[model samples]
Each structure stands twice: as structure tokens, then as C-alpha cells.
Target chain A: MDEMSAESRYADWIAVHAGQSDLRAWALAADGSVRAELTLPSDSAMPEAPAFEAKLLDTIAPWLGQGSTSVLACGLTGLADLPEAITPVPAKPAERLPIRVSANDPRLDLLALPGLSQANPPDLLLGEETEVAGFLAGNPGFDGVLCLVGPRTVWVQISAEEIVSFQTAMTGEFFDLLAGHSTISAAVASTGMDAEAFVDAVSDTLSRPERLSQRLAALRGQHVLQQLDPSVARSRLFGALIGAELAAMRPYWLGQQVALAGPSDMVDLYARALDTQGVSAPRHASDGLALAGLARAWFAMQEHAK
Target chain B: MDEMSAESRYADWIAVHAGQSDLRAWALAADGSVRAELTLPSDSAMPEAPAFEAKLLDTIAPWLGQGSTSVLACGLTGLADLPEAITPVPAKPAERLPIRVSANDPRLDLLALPGLSQANPPDLLLGEETEVAGFLAGNPGFDGVLCLVGPRTVWVQISAEEIVSFQTAMTGEFFDLLAGHSTISAAVASTGMDAEAFVDAVSDTLSRPERLSQRLAALRGQHVLQQLDPSVARSRLFGALIGAELAAMRPYWLGQQVALAGPSDMVDLYARALDTQGVSAPRHASDGLALAGLARAWFAMQEHAK
Candidate 1:
């Protein structure tokens, strides 16, 4: 089949998701094969609805093509869940039906998905649901915990195609806040990840999590008084926070077959922290999972249409 | 003796201390009586050395007439510990020798006290030691844990006029970061602390401090989803951080008589939190205690000089 006719054989689609600071887009073939993926800085002014829609389309223009490629996007806040496309489904754990929005744009066919919300334990996820959908699609009958380690790290318990219970930690966000703006910023470097300090600090905090606040301040004190290395201080701060998080998340991963999906650095930290807890979590690439998730949702829509 | 002759008899002095954001000055009569007290915003450029000194002198000029009054200042950071007047003393539990700096300013006879340092467990205190000193002087023969709660809250175990051991927590600093700049800022009001939420949060977190980071994020989530009152959120955040601090300091207060000295709001929180732990810590006025501590140190210097 020629390239033009071959493209015509399958419906091409685009999957886009908005994050705290960025919007991610992935072009996919009908068979759930990712063709291209890219990211653009997102507008945080989420309440200003149509402006963001215009921004989203403008951001993804480079990937938009001549073909009638359908766009499937997900947003957690109400802005993405337009009244026209919303289909409220009964809440279930493994998979909840996402409300969708029809992108009323002439350049491309677009559908935006509603973010997931759980009443019990009360949690929310904006763009991560598609990633979970994609991961579940790849690992059929996967019954375990799915942890997405990022600015907003989330741990979800899944069984029999339902999300059982989940919890989130602002661990990554806290690290950013401290390292970027707080007094501890002096003791933390921007890019270096100290493996030894990370592991040791994790062990130290897990053994004595109550000393968290003191230890956090001690990073600055140690730097001034004890000659604590800035790189190690950064790692220790990271490790201490993640360590405390794992302490609270112990019940979630203690006996579960755990896996992580996120950026490399965060997943590495999460995976390493879990190892110390005697829980080994394998990591999958975040981009693939996100793209696969969008494709899965698009295909599911087609099936439902039939 | 008349008031003027009485002031001249013993040589009146002033004790000033620099805090994280404010400079507190206390005027004292020859007999260690507090004559007057006031505060001014501190120059944050602490490392510049002379600026703080200038600021100290400038802030206290209104109280500094040509009365042959001596001035002693305490700096939390070593920045204020200039070399000229330093008197090194042996490290003891209740007190460590503070390095003193002769202000050398033509306007007044000034000496600046250095903060205390511990070689093991590696800790530092700026101005609190003076307050602790003054606290001890008034309550002579008093023995137990003295907690000076502020930006850097310190718990000192004292016995026989020596600081036996001390620990520090940056609980106040962490709350400032979260409530002012971090993600939790969205749910926190700049002013108005909620006492009920503070107590309840203290109780909840005292039992489960490992969940500190999670509970913090939950405050924002609760605000977004459940419309949690902003004041309550502020109190909850305050309670959680303080509760964690109390958890770590449990050893210091569990079986010991505890008393608090610091800003009223902070001391009240600590006292309330301690009360929840079944420990009744008598609240002492911070300004008076700080002045007393400085006066005690000055008199100790007079005795040492003789």
C-alpha cells in the first residue's frame, strides 16, 4: 500500500493532555501505534476556558495534518468537560467512564476527556487517567498498584478492571517548592541526583520518620555547620520526603505487584525508595503509557459508537 | 537613692536580639529591670555584617541617650558574632560560651553575643540562648525542658544552670513556606488562624505524623472539592507541622516539666499541642523572658569581669 492509501486505511488520531505547567500531545495510528509526541507550556489560567482551547490548538498545530485526524484530549477541571460532550457514567474503580468534550474547531476533530474523581477517600486525577487506561490496555488483567511519580505523585490500587483505592502525595511539588524558593534552596542543587545520599537518607528517614521537619531544617544547618555537600543535601531532602511518603503508602505497596509510570528521575527515586521497603516496582516509560492511554480511549469510543 | 543615681550606681544596659524578620530591643535598668521594649523590621541582608549593626543601633537610638548604658546584642546567625569582644567559655549543658562582638559604634558601648553551637548532634541557636538565660535567672533552681518556640523553635533540657541538651525544629519556617508559596498557599489565608482546626489537626497528626505531606496536600484538595474553610486549612497545616515537631520532642516533654517562651500565637499553639499530649506547659511572656535572659547574661559578664 502506498503511504497516502496506507494512511487512509486507518483513522489517525491525536491524544492531548494538559498538566500543571505543560500540555502533552501524541499522534497515533488507528492500531494504537504512536507516530509523534510533543509538549508545550500550558496556560495555568484554566478558568478562562475558550482561550485555553485556542492555546491548545495553537500548541498542537505542528502535529495537525491534512487528514481528518481526530483529537482526543483530557482535562480534569470543568473547562475541558464542555456541556455538549459530557457523558456521566456510574463511578467504578478500575475504569470510570470519562466525560468528553467535542472540540468545536475547523482545523481538526477534537474530543476532550473529563478527569477522574472518586468520592470515597476523595481524590482526583486530571490527565493521568488516560495513561492508566493505556497501561491497563498493554498489561491485560493486571491486578496491582499503579504509581505515577511526578509533581503530583499518585498511587492507585487496581483489581479486576476497577480502581479500588488511591492516594496522592505532593512530594515532588514540595521538593520543587523547597529547592526553588525556600531557605533550603541554598543547600540544594538544581540537577544533581546523589544516589548514595538518596539511599542513605531514605533509610534514615524510614527508620525515624517523626524527625522529618527537624531533619529538613538540619539540611541547612548541616550545610553551614557540618560541611554537608549540596548535592547530598538535595538527595537527602528528596529521600527524606519520599521516605516519609513511602511510610504512609506502606499499606498500598506492601504486598502488591507494584509498577511506576512517570518521568525517569521521579520513577527512579520511587523505584529505589520502594526497594528499601522490600517492594520492587518496575518502571514503564511515561510517554508511551500516555499515548497508549489516549489511543485506548479513542478505540473504546469507536467500539461504543458501533 | 534617686532614680537617676540608682541608674548610675550599677550602670544601666540594653539587650537587643535579632530574629528571623524583626529586631527586638529591650532596655534594662542597672538592677536587671526591663525599662522599655520595642521592635523593628530586620534587614534581611544578614551577611553584610555592618548593616545589621547599623540597624541595631538605629533601631535602639531612641532609647540610647548618653546615660553610660551598655548594649549587648544576640545574633542567631554567626553573621553578628564579630571577633573583638568574644569571650570563649567551656561548653556546658545549660550554656555554651557565646562569642561577643564590641559594637565599636561611637553612639553607644555595645557588645554582640554569639549564638550557641553543639559539636555533636550538630545544632546552632542565634538569640534564643539569651532568652533562655534570662528565663533561668528569674526562675532560679528551676529544672526541666524549656522550649523557646518561634521561627526556629528550640527545646533545651536544663539542669543546674547548664543547657543539658537542645534540639531545634524549623516548623514555623516550613509553615511560612507552605502557607505563603507552596501549593498549600491556594487554600491558606494570609491571616486569621483557626484554633479549633489547629487543635483537631494537632490531635489527628500527633497520632499519624508519617502522613504529614499527604495531609498537607489534602488541605488543598479538600478546599477545591469540599470547600474546606481557609482558616481551618491554615490551622490544620499549622497543627500538622507542630504535631510532627511535638512527636519528635516527645522525649523532652513526656515526663518533664515544660514551659514555653516565644511569640504569643506560637507559644499558644505549642502549649495547646502539649496539652493534647497531656503535658501542661506554663506559658511565659516572650518579651519579658528575652529581656530577662539578656540582663542575666550582662550581669554574668559583670561578675566575670570583676
Candidate 2:
């Protein structure tokens, strides 16, 4: 089974999200179990169309079998108005479709899926849409806000399997800048998450959003004034940024059914933040969602194939 | 004169704000005219007492005469509760004194000024305090909000010649990061300012402060969606950040007599922001304000000398 023999190609589907710096793919066995996963840095070259396709194939070559299998992909950035793709928001979930991209790999029938986009506010999500779709597929009739805390956090309003509206915050990028790229890096520890400090900081900023900048400086101030613990500093910074985000995103999570889908620790933070608002959210692990979303897309394409 | 002469050193006072990256000083003649100005990078070495003084004298060597002079200085970071420094807040302006630093450079009698500190908020202003003092000295009996828009913007409320309260915003550093250092940098022109777009952006963020992060991402979205002009992108980003800042700082400028002190262009932007709120702010050129502030301290020191 470990060998890449012809019989090994029994996997039914694969899903790939070609991000700017990294490429991640999931392979689903015939029984819909995630059979294999692959991750590789995509920074070897810019994603010129053919090169990107070839790179995707090279990264997942081990999982490929001589048997033709359907593959679905989504890039890190969204593509709009693709003829084959579904307009998730403007249409009913049951009638929606995923964008289909032509991939010229011999062993795979590859179709690239479209990410979500909003026309009026001009919002876009490339890869996370599939994850959301997968989450919806698993939890049918899930209606409420889904918060995905990733490199960019997206808060989407989902009702009856449809994405109503969504907003993205630069939470992760902001965190990266504060912890490693900005002036405050010297004063904060990039590691460790202090639950208590994170909660308090979140609460502090939520009440006084006007003091966001001052409080940011106070991270350094406390570092100087009281020898602030590095873990505490990290927590404070996270809390402040997230607090500001929550303030902006209050309408989405306030007194609503909230579900969080992202990495475990990030989901934990978001869960805790919402908890303070007297809102309880169910936490879901986001592993298999991408493949599930791709499987959905593949199933849709089969309808097209017929 | 091309030559450094003894008579040239006859200036009665020197004022310096030793910053993290640069040192700026002003030489005050006996009659209070700015005799000369000097600036140099402060990063040649750490600001140890001897080296800092030596570096200070060396940079202002051409302006120094043989005459004994009192030097007043402010470091870039606050030193709270220093015995040698006077606590100005809650003290009458007439009774305030500079924090005297013992300098090895015998060419001048140097007294380092103490920056302002806020205990409740854990805020500090190292160099801007002197500038505020200078602006107050120049515009005596003026009581309202004074905004010094520099590397760090400070809004101070003044009444009866005493510093009432102030708030600091990392506007400048935040702008630098967003335009030149962050992921959005590529989408924005790091140089030009688009006045119209700026004003519009400021208004947008002001109304929806919670959408700041979402709007930041929208800068990039606009780039892809509409091919947003780099200059316009820059303007919009600036406007959004400042707008969010203004939203937080509404109490300072709303229906208050506002005064701005900083570089001309920065003051212009800030003035325009206040103007939108029906607050007309007189812009004061920040040049020589530090020296004037140090001069104020020098006069106070003379009273102590008596």
C-alpha cells in the first residue's frame, strides 16, 4: 500500500489550494476518508499558469495512480465571474456550482474551484470558501456565523447552507507584523498564549476602541514599566488586535449561533473571545473540510460530465 | 562663518532632543533668537552619558562659542520619578524645572528635561513634551487641545498653564508600516498623498471604525477589482488609518479649539481632518519649538540659579 503502484490510484478525489508561498492538497480514498495529505513550499517560482499546474502535480505525485481520478483546486486568490463556478451568495445553496479549471495532468481529471467573492463590498476569499463549503456539507442545515481564523480571518453569515454575507479582517497578518515585523516585536514574545491576559486585553479594547493606538504603545510601556512577561505581552497584543476585530465584527457574533473553523489554537482564542460576550460557540476541527469541499465540487462536476 | 570661532560659542543656551535615530539641537542667543541648528544620527553608539554628551557637542560644534551655556535635553524615552527631573504635571508652569543630566562635556552645562508620563494609562512622551512646552510658551494663555503630529502624535489638553491630560497615537509609525513595511505596501504608493481620496477615506473609516481591518484588506481588493491607482491607494490607506484614529480621538477635536504642531505637510493633513469635524486648527511649524521649549526650561533654571 505504501508503494505508488497502479492499484494505488484507487483514491477517488484530491483537492488542492495553491497558496502564494505554500501548496496544500488532500487525497480522499474511495470511501471518502482523507487518505493522504501533502504540503510543499510553492515559492520556487511565480505561479505562471503551466508552471503552477506542474508544481501542483510534482508535489502530489506520490499520491497519483495510473487510474484517472478527479481533482479539484482553488488558488490562494479568488477568481470572479468564472462561467463554470457557482455564485454562492446570489443563488440558493442547492443550485450553486464550483468553478472548473482545465488541468492537463494525464493521471488526473483536474478542475479548479472558484473561491467566494462579494460584488458590492468587493470582498474575495480564494481557498477558505471550499473549507466553509466542506464544513457546511458535514453539518447540513447549519445556520449562523462561521468564523475562520487563518492568515486572514473571515466571518461569514451562513443560513440554510448559503453564504449570506462575509467580512475579512487582517487579524493574522496584523499579528505577524506586531510579533515579528513591527517595532513592538522587541517588547513582545511571539510564542505563548496567556488566556487570562488575552481575555482582559480583549475586553479592555472592546470598551475603549478609541484607545487602540495608545494601548498598542502600552504593550511596550508595560514592557518597560513593569518588566511584563513575554507571554503576557503576546497575549495582550493578540487580545488588543482581536478585540478591535470583535468590535468591528460584533454584529456577526453577538447573540448568534457561532461556529469556529480554523487551526485549533486560533479557534480556541476566538471561542474564548466570544465566550466573554456571553456567547457560546461550537468549535470544529477544520481537517477534512477542504477535501470534503472538493468532493462536493467533484460531485457537481459529475452532473456536468453527464 | 566658515571657521568655528570662540565668539560663536557665546550663545547662552542649547536645547536638544536626543532621539533613537537622530539628535536635533537648537542654539539660543542671549536675546532668544535661534543662533544655529544642528542634526546628526544618534545611532553611532548607544547613548551612554559621556558619548551622548560628546556626540551632542560634536554635532553642534560649529554653533558653540567659548561662552558658558546651559544645555537642556530630553531623551526619547521617559524616565519617571527621577530625582533630578522636575514633575511638571500638577505643578505650576512657573515652578517647573528641567531634569538636570550630569554631562562630562564641559563646553556646556547640560540639563536633560523630563518627558511627560500618564500613570493611569501607562503612557509616556519623551521628546514631544518639550515641543508642547515650547508651543505653550509661544502661545501663552492658550487653552484647548494641542495636537503634535510627529513620529508619535500627542493630543494634550491644557488649562491654566498646567498639562491636564493627553493621549498618544502611533499614527506616524503605523503609516510607515502600512505604506512601506506591511503586506499592503505593494498596493500603495509609499510617496504621494491623494488629498481627495484621503478625505473620503478618512470619512469612511470615521463612520465605521469597526471596519478598519476589513477596509484595509479592501485596499488590495480594490487593486484587483478596479486596478486602484497606487497614489489613490496610498491616500485611501492613509485616510482610513487616520480616520480610525480620528474616530478614537473625537473628544479631542470635536467642538474644541484645536492647534497642530508638526511638519508642515503632516500638520496640513491633520488640520484637514479636524476641519471635517468643524474644528479649525491653526498650524504651527514645529521647527525650533524644541529649542524654544528648552529655552523656556533655561529661563526657569535661571530662576533656580538665583
Candidate 3:
């Protein structure tokens, strides 16, 4: 079976399971078109899953149960434990989605899927990457592509023939390190955001990004001498650092419409801040893109008789 | 003239000056009785004569022109140098107002009033006991009483028959020493008030006022690597000390109406805090109540003859 027939089969399975419940689905086409859409109640209690899985369910669940909704999950083994009703599809090695391995943690290799390449898998993604690569190479018929971007920011770029590509930002990890452990952490006094101060600080950094490194010293001086009011300064520092990351990533996401998947409050604040710089408010999705991505890969393999 | 006749005559003079454009009269009373009164312009500039003559001219100039006022100056060695129209009334040794003397200053003895008893004055009055007693004895005909409350909180109690007393408070001085100069001052981070944290610390001290002295330990601990938030603890210590003073003074000021005369903002805050303990708001008077009390004493003697 070719990739087209395999994608149709996976779409059929999604439509059947979605109709049985209140699930939604969206068929991601080859040319970046989203079709076969359906909507579910906004306040629906979604199935609990890992962070990535939950994201995918939220996004695709809205479009599920409408008809035969096609979704291409590039890696199957990663979604093997997902709800048994969702079939896994697979695709060729060339069509397989790319997973960048930046950190070399050992435990991750235990979870790697076939056809997933790791330039430096550290010690973790080694096993899982091979399995993921094999699953994708065995079947050339997955519908959509799922791209896992870094450990925190994940993007699921969908297409009917295959998932084209996706990207992730290390935003959450960066925030944790900066606030939790570094000397810079001491400069901030409060965890909650102050909107006006934050906006002002971000605007300052955006205009003079080169001064980013010097911000830590200024914050420390103000706090030590009791010259700066702490509440205002803390909010400003958080905004400035986050602004620096956003500035760096501007080129990749310039024209792309993306969904946000994270803690609600943080996402809301980030969205508001992003909107100030002309970024659209992100669409929130519930389904774990990785699970759907994996299921799509499995079904493709079955269709190929691999 | 007897005390009653003396007071009545002064009152009449004040009434006469009250109608004059350049004359104003103020009297200080003690224990519901008039002790001294003086007359001057409702808006008089500083007098130009020698200290004693200037004080006298300030009193009569409002009623008589320079020519008529000098005519009253005959036979007075202190008055001979004055314009003939101005009369120099001999101030009674009994009517001399007491001058405040610093407890530690040796220069105080040179100007000590003669013929006054060197005995204990009231504790509510500020200054050395000898100075207050001496002034009261030498200035018997003076109805104005100079009462220095503490180093900063000064009150002049005057009456028409004799000058009474004045008092001052050292509260501001104490605050300056603790928060600006001493070792405890070094511990505090120079910062604006953190209202909630400060109030909490103050309330804590209120419960254990006896421990007020040791509360500075928290600030010192932070300074010496005790791993506490130094800025917060320092503010708390300051608040606690202020609270302690308030607690101490509450007993002395029961039921009587007291006026606060100082910097507007500090007075306002202190009044608000005092109100929390059922004390009424203090009326704010202008500064230099001490000088005004002394002037009132001088004028009271002049009125005794009429």
C-alpha cells in the first residue's frame, strides 16, 4: 500500500472512534491545509496524558468524530500506549519527521522510536530513536507529520501526505534555570508578573538587546542598595529575559500560525506579551501531538503490510 | 499690682491691640488658668531692636506709632537708647521667662535667670530642672510658661498672670540615631517602607514590647550571614521600635487633647497610628511655639502696670 491509501485508512479509524465519543479531529493536508474539522465543548474534561500527548489530544480532539479525519503520526512506538482505538500509521525513512537531539540524557534512548536519527543521542535517545526510525522506514503511508521541538516547546505540523516539520522553543527550561538556580534568580523578588513593569522592561530590551548581559548587574545593584522598588524590578527582569528569547526566535515563526501548549496562566501572559510584538494569539490544543504522531506512523506500517 | 489686677490689665491691652491692623495677641494657659498674654501684629515681621527691646517694641508698636511708643521709654537704661515715643517697661525679675538649657552644655550657666529657685520642674517639661525652676522664680509677673516636652515635641504653656511651662519629645531624635547613625542603622537596607512587612513586625513587637531591644537581632543576623532577608528584617526592627515608643507614651497622654506640630507627613502618620489606640487626632500648630511662649511672657509684664 502506498502513503495515500495508508493515510485514508488511518483517517477512517479516527472518524469511527471520534463518532463513538465526543472527540474532535482535524485532517492535516499535504499543503498545510487543516480539514475534516469538528468542535467539542471548550470545557470538556480531556483524557490525562503526558504533556505532549495532552497537547495533541486538545488540538485534534476538536476536529475528531466528524468524518474520516486523517492525521499523520510520523513515529508509532512513541504512541503505542495511547488509547488503543487510535490506529498508528507509519511512513518511509525519507518521509519520517526529524527529531533534534540536543541533550544527551541516557534514559531518553530507552524511549526512542525507529527512523529517528540523533547526531548525539547522549545516552538516552539511542534505543528509542532506532525503534522510531525502523517504524517509519517499514511503512511509507503515514498521513501527517509530528515534530517534537526540544524538551518543552513542541510543535505538531500536520499534512495529509506526511507531517512536513515542526519546531520547539526551550522557553520553559530557560525560565526554570534563570529563576530557580542562577545568580540572576536572586535579582527577581516575586514570581507573579506585573504587567506594566514587565511590558516596559521588555520594550527596553527589545530596543537594546545588547544590554541583556548587563541587566543582572543593574538588578543586583538596585536591590542591594534598596534604590529600586523590588516588586517593580522583579517583573521587569523577567520580562526582559523572556523578550530576549522571543527576539532570537523571531525569524523561524515570522509568518507561521502556531498553537500554544503549556500551563494556562503562563501561556496567557506569554500570548499577551507576544501579541504586543505582532504575533497572533496562539490556538490552544489538548491532544498530545506525539501520540497522534505515533499512531499515524503505526497505521501507515499496517497499510504497507510491513 | 496683684495677680488678678495684672491679668485683667493685660487682657484689656490685648483687646485694644486685637483691633489694631498690625497687632496680634496670644496667651498660654496651664491647668485651665491664664498664665501669660502678648499682643503683636496679626502678621508682624521680626523686630529690629536689641533682643529685650525688640521684644518690648514688638508688643507696643502695634498700638502706638514710633513717636508715641518711644515717649514711654524714659528712665529705663535698657529703654534710653530706644526712640522716645516707645516706652521701655521694666520687665519684673519675677516675670522673666525661663530659657531652655541643654543637659550636657556648660554654656547654659552664663544666661541662667537670677532670683529663681533651682529646683525640680515637672517631668513632662523638657530641659534641665534648674533652668525651668530659675525662669519661673525670676519671672513671677510673667504669665507665659515655657514648657519643653522632649527634644523635639515642645509645648509652651502660658497665661496672663505668669508664664507657665513648655515641654518637648525626643522621639524624632531617637529614630534618627537608631535608623541613621548607630550599628542598627548599618543593618537596615536603605529602602522605602514595605507596609505589610513593617506592620507585621510592629504588631509582633506590640505583643512582646519587652523584647523590643532584642528585635534588632533579626537585622543583625541578616547582616552577619544568618541567611535571612535583611531588608525585610531591618524594616521590621524600625517599625517595632517606633511601636514601642508609642506604647510607652500612651499612658501619659490619656484623655487630654494634644496637638502635634512638626513635618506634616510624619505628624499625619503618627496621628493615624495613635488613633488606632483610641487617641484622638492631634491638631498641628506652626513651629516656634517656644519663642512665642517667651514673647508672651515679656508682654504680660508690660500689661501689669496699666
* DockQ measured for candidate 2: 0.31
Q: What docking tier does model 1 reach?
A: acceptable
lDDT at residue A298 of model 1 (Cα atoms): 71
- The residue-by-residue lDDT of candidate 3 on A192-294, one tens digit each, is 6678988877667666543443343345434433435666776776666556545545543456554454446556656665666777654333233333444
DockQ: the better of candidates 2 and 3: 2
Displacement of the residue A301 alpha carbon in candidate 1, Å = 3.2
In Å, what is the interface RMSD of model 2?
Answer: 4.2
- Give TM per candidate: 0.82, 0.80, 0.29
Q: Write the per-residue lDDT of candidate 1 for residues B1-306, one digit (tens) a residue.
A: 234443333336777777766778877777777666677775322344566667666667766666445777776434454332222222342343334454557666756666666555666666666777778767887789999887778898887777767788878878887887665687786577888889988988889888887788777556655667888888889999999998777888999999888889889889999998889999988877656666666766777779
Please give the lDDT score at residue A289 for candidate 1: 69
Off by over 4 Å in 1: A1-15, A25-38, A41-71, A76-110, A189-191, A302-306, B1-15, B25-38, B42-71, B80-110, B190-196, B302-306
| Per-prediction DockQ | 0.32, 0.31, 0.01
